[model samples]
Target: MFQSIPWLESNSELWLQISIVGLGLGAIVLFAETLHRLTGNSSELARKVVHIGTGNVILVAWWLQIPAWVGISASIIASLIALLSYYIPILPGINSVGRKSLGTFFYAISIGVLVAWFWPLQQFHYAAVGILVMAWGDGLAGLIGQKFGQHPYEVWGMKKSWEGSLTMALVSYAVSCLILLSVQGNVWQTWLVPVAIAIVATALESVSKLGIDNLTVPLGSAALGYYLSQLLPLGS
Candidate 1:
């Protein structure tokens, strides 16, 4: 298993960094969720604050290491734009878009660009794939689950559903695999890496007792992708 995965051998440090970031994000999300639950607020505000703070940290870290001004600027600007859009309301009928939704979309895109620009180039494809998967998969799952979920499974005293969870897992896996394979130039091995990532990400999504899927899913998916890439001929 170890011998088959060359990306891991070459980029272990990158994976470690990704994992650490993921853990930090997860911790913050959990804290925010707890506070929101206790105070009867949406906790969306808390999440935005964390998002901006984390984006700054990521920008500094990447800038010091990479000297990539484009990415650093994008991260800061995108985050600010996202936050501002929440309050300023950019377009006509923009309020229909919803602040949280807009904020999350911009935040996810910024993270995706940052990861793509700063992380090891060889593993950049995986990180990008993971980001896309987290954004679309989680968003769709939440929307569909809320609107259509009739039967619910009680998880951690919350009413969730097998249908929603399954949808999240499947969509995340499919999208991640498609993106990774396209970038890595290895369409055949898609089954090996993406499936593993999907499963891990899905499991994390299912039991995210901390409401940190934003932080957990992308990073977790990246780790799983990295590990799988080691076992399969994944990236450059």
Candidate 2:
């Protein structure tokens, strides 16, 4: 059911889902802000919390079967908010992570893109894969890499550690496999798709410039998984 508009009357769940989505995202930001305050304004950690938390909203959309337009609308709105935060303190703990990067903005855009691509097709699981990949994979990779990454290397003038790259690969594979397995069941495509997506996602994350990885990794992983699954026979 669609949400009712002015001069229109009918049953619609659109506004309900939108309210849930708004509350969900708002809670994430509130939690992140609280963390920032408690931890002496550790923007980086708080930002990661927001990163991981916001990405999980795809799950909510999937479970509720929210309409594509609503999801896309939310994403576009979030992207605008993220972009605006870059110049202002609108998202104090998020954009000002002491880094010159557009990862937050890119992340929001990727969500919108994935929802627009998959929701209408009723293949929202792929959207889940993409968002969770960015959420857990990239989020954990950054955290673990900074904390444990010892051997560092530079890619296109950006420094990264082997530890982080490995984390990204393994996490991407797991997230992909988990979501895909549920959608396609135990099958060859399930294994192969995640493996390929994982490899590509790691490579994308490694060469990320100005946070472009936020855009590339999830889109690439989800698209690759979709195409690869189409090629292989899936189980029921």
Candidate 3:
């Protein structure tokens, strides 16, 4: 059955690329684990290390032109491992956020969904925008909020800070703009899409409960980015 799938076929170059991606991802997890255990780092710190680091895999997949099947398969395997980490110590440092969460699982699912949605369309920029927003935007927000969040507020029983939200918005805007501008040129839509995506991503992240934004932010940002890109078109 697998033989019939053309994507199943692979070349030596593909294998090498796949191996590099795997090792890079493995090294990230190992580094997070080492940081957690050796340095007595907080679980949240270790998890964010993995979070910010692993979300970068989208770049690797895009750069190497990894097949959609491989991306999807890797996501599925990652989702399973994240789910299992709740019970087992598989990369415990990455998931031990000191609270109930399926953030890791949702994050993995976002990758698979983005690859499935845009890989065939050859619009990888949207996928990159989504994951990078989550990686840099959300990831940096958490780090900044933890360290320098003096003005704390509550959103639907969730605590947050303006500093963090601003970080998310700014990073989301920057990430989307850089990706879209490179692909779509210096158009008004390019500017508008990033602003829209930044607002939407920040809103979704601000009210996230139990890490639901992991699923919502990336997929939502990508979809909205693509949608607005079509609606606004390149002009002005």
Candidate 4:
């Protein structure tokens, strides 16, 4: 089965790179959130937009194989500066519209660009699947959960809903499988990988007791998909 997809043999580095990138992004989000709370400021939409947009641009530049430490250092510096600006309260005059939705969109874009850069040239199809799952699946889960979540489930002492989590998992897995099969030409195999990724993503999103879902879901799902693809003999 692996023989059918020769690309995987040469593209192992891509997966590793993506995993590293995802983890890095997650860490940055965690740090930013902590900083925001410490400063007594909500992690508003403007802040998120700057973080996501700048982060994506930096990751894309790195993906172009420009340099290693250059992009990483620049991202770190920029993030630190953004965090500091929150304390200083630089922008008091400008108000933006759809800050939350816009931030989420750019956040999703950052993840997508990272996947695009690190994954094997053709494995982009799989990455795209992961991206869409993170954006749409998580987005719908939040929207529905906020509006209609009545029954709450306490998992690890966190207030989450089985209803919302289940919704996120099902939608994410379905979308992921559809995209993967359609794009990777692997329509016959059991959907174990997609299911596993959905579960991981949902769990992470639900238990984001630390308010880091914006960062974790995308990277976690993508990494899960990448690893599962290896075990499933998918023709990446």
User: Compared with the true structure, what per-residue lDDT tens digits does model 3 show for residues 1-236?
Assistant: 44464554537688888999999999998998999999887788888988899989898899998999999999999999888888876666677534488889999999999999999999998999999999889999999998999999899899999999999999999999998888988878878888889999999999888899999999999999998877877763
State each model's CA lDDT, in order: 0.59, 0.87, 0.90, 0.57
Instruction: Give the number of the best model, judged by lDDT.
Output: 3
Judged by TM-score relative to the true structure, which candidate is superior, 2 or 4? 2
Q: Backbone clashes per model, in order?
A: 2, 0, 0, 0
True-vs-predicted CA distance for residue 176, candidate 3, Å: 0.7
Candidate 1 structure lDDT: 0.59
**How good is model 3 by TM-score?**
0.93
Q: List ranges where model 3 is wrong by over 4 Å.
A: 1-10
Residues 113-193, model 1: lDDT tens digits: 546543756455655655666666766666667668877787665567777788888888788767765666656677667
lDDT of 4 by residue, 1-236 (tens): 43456687566666566556556655655565555656765545324433433344333434444333443444455445444443454442111332222333334344544444444454554455555666567666765675678888786666776677877998888878776666565554437778788888898777664346756776777777777767766443
Ranking, lDDT, top scorer first: 3, 2, 1, 4
Badly placed stretches (over 4 Å) of model 4 are 1-85, 88-113, 116-122
lDDT per residue, candidate 2, 1-236, as tens digits?
87657633343466777789899999999999888887886688998999899989899999999888887888888888887787778767777734689898899899999999998888899888888998999999999999999989999998899999999999999999889888778877878788998899999999789999999998998898788767775642
Against the true structure, candidate 4 has what lDDT? 0.57
Q: Cα deviation in Å at residue 124, candidate 2?
A: 1.0
Ranking by TM-score: 3, 2, 1, 4
Instruction: Return the lDDT, model 2, position 146.
Output: 92
